[model samples]
Target: MADIKVIIPAYNEVDSIAHVVNELPKSVSEVIVVNNNSSDNTVKNAETAGATVITELRKGYGYACLKGLEYIASKSKQPDIIVFIDGDYSDYPEELDNVVAPILEDDIDFVVGARRKNLREEGSMTPQQVFGNWLATFLMRLFFGAKFTDLGPFRAIKYDKLKELNMEDKTYGWTVEMQLKILKKKMTYTEVPVRYKRRIGISKVSGTVKGSIFAGIKILGWIFKYSIK
Candidate 1:
């Protein structure tokens, strides 16, 4: 079995952080939750749930994720695979094994947990989120001949391949950046359908107008930026 590590970026998700931590499949060697300047009990709850909680004072999704990567890079024993999941408990953390299965069994370089509509609970994704996912993926298909369906947060990637991508997004462009780089490098990738449900608290991105606009702009910016390259 591959040594798998999970990274979860959380900001004021105290209501759902513990559930996300405890429900993770024991197959993962460690769960690291990067608390992105949360004012709630996120850190304490994540610790109680048996996750190695780290604080990232920076306030961006990518910043928190990069902090988790930094912590992993410092460890003497490196993981074989790294998985990124949200701390909102919207994704079924118990399905982690299924998410990483492609990478472990098929030797795929990267995997994204696709939140297929049929598998997703109604209202799990807001209108803007749905449209944005569609538009971004549509653009990817048109410009890059990519096959991605959803930009869902639950994902897994080979540690080495992840490092090779040289991820630098410090905000909403993180997911799209990874996908674009994978496509650019011609790396093998696949998506696994995963069940999804409404998040415990309101979303930091899709729940608000400002977040939605910024995220959309960032995602689209990454795609277009790569298209011209």
Candidate 2:
């Protein structure tokens, strides 16, 4: 079996972090939850749920995820695959096997757990999120002939391929940035339909006007920047 590790970027997800950690499949060798400067009991709860918690201090999803990657880089034995998931309890954590299967079985470089509309619960995604996904994906198709349908966070990538991408996004643009880089690098990728539900507590990105606007800008900026490059 390939060694796999999970990275979860959490910001003030005290109410839902534990559930997300506890539900992860046991095949994951380590569950690293990077607490993004949460004032609540996020760290404590994640630790109690058997996740190795790290503090990013900086409040960005990408920052927290980078911290987790740094921790893995310091480990004596690195993982074969890295799976990134959100700590909002919206995604079915137990379905991680489905996310990584293509990489393990077919030697695919990347796999995204696409939250198909048929599998998503009502209102799981906000209006802005839906439109933004559509626009960004449509542009990816138009510009690059990419087949991506959703910019879902629940995704997995080969460790070496991930390192080659040199991911540097420190905020809302992380997911799209990865996708764009994958396209530019000509990496093999696939998507697995996954179930999504209303997250526990409010969403940090889609729940606020400021977050929505910034995320939309960041996502579109990555697409357009790559389109011209």
Candidate 3:
């Protein structure tokens, strides 16, 4: 069995973090929740729910994720796989088994849990978010002949393959950066359909006009920058 670890980047998700932690499959070896400077009960809740909680003073999604990676690196034994998921309870954490199945069963390098329209709850995704995913994925397909459809947060990858990507995005561009690098490296990857629902509280990114606009710019910037390279 592959030693699997999950990293959850939470920002003020106090209302939902515990549920997210409790629902993960038993196969997961560890659940690491990175509280991204949340001034709430997120840390307490996650710890109560049996997750190894860590704090990221920097308030970016990538910052929290990188913090988790650093913690894993400092451990005596490293996990064979790493899974990234949101702490908003929007994704079905129990489906973690499915998220990493491709990597375990087929020797795949990376797997993304695609939030398909049919499986997603009504209003789970905002219009801007929907359009952003479409535009970003379309650009990727046009530029690199890629088959990615959604920049979903629920995803998994092999530890060694993840290290090779040398991830550096510290904010809204993290997801796209990973996908772009996977394409650049010609790594084996696939997408698994996953159910999605409305998050418990307002989203830090898609719920605000400013956050949405900045996220779009960051995503596009990475795509265009990589296309030229």
**TM-score on alpha carbons, each prediction:** 0.99, 0.99, 0.99
- Among residues 3 or more apart in sequence or in different chains, the pairs in candidate 2 whose N, CA or C atoms overlap within 3 Å are none
Ranking by lDDT: 3, 1, 2
Report the number of the highest-lDDT candidate: 3
Candidate 1 or 3, higher lDDT? 3
RMSD of each: 0.6, 0.6, 0.5
Per-residue lDDT of model 1, residues 1-229, tens digit only: 7899999999999999999999998899999999999999999999999999999998999999999999999999999999999999899999999999998889999999999999999999999999999999999999999999999899999999999999999999999999999999999999999999999999999999999999999999999999999
In the range 67-135, model 2's lDDT, one tens digit per residue, is: 999999998998999999999999999999999999989999999999999999999999999999999
Predicted candidate 3 versus true structure: per-residue lDDT over 44-137, tens digit per residue:
9999999999999999999999999999999999999999999999999999999999999999999999999999999999999999999999
Score residue 176 of candidate 2 by CA lDDT: 97
Q: How many steric overlaps does candidate 3 have?
A: 0
How does candidate 2 score on lDDT? 0.95
Model 2 residue runs over 4 Å out of place are: none
Q: List the residue pairs that clash in candidate 1.
A: none
lDDT of each: 0.96, 0.95, 0.97
Alpha carbon lDDT at 212, candidate 3:
100
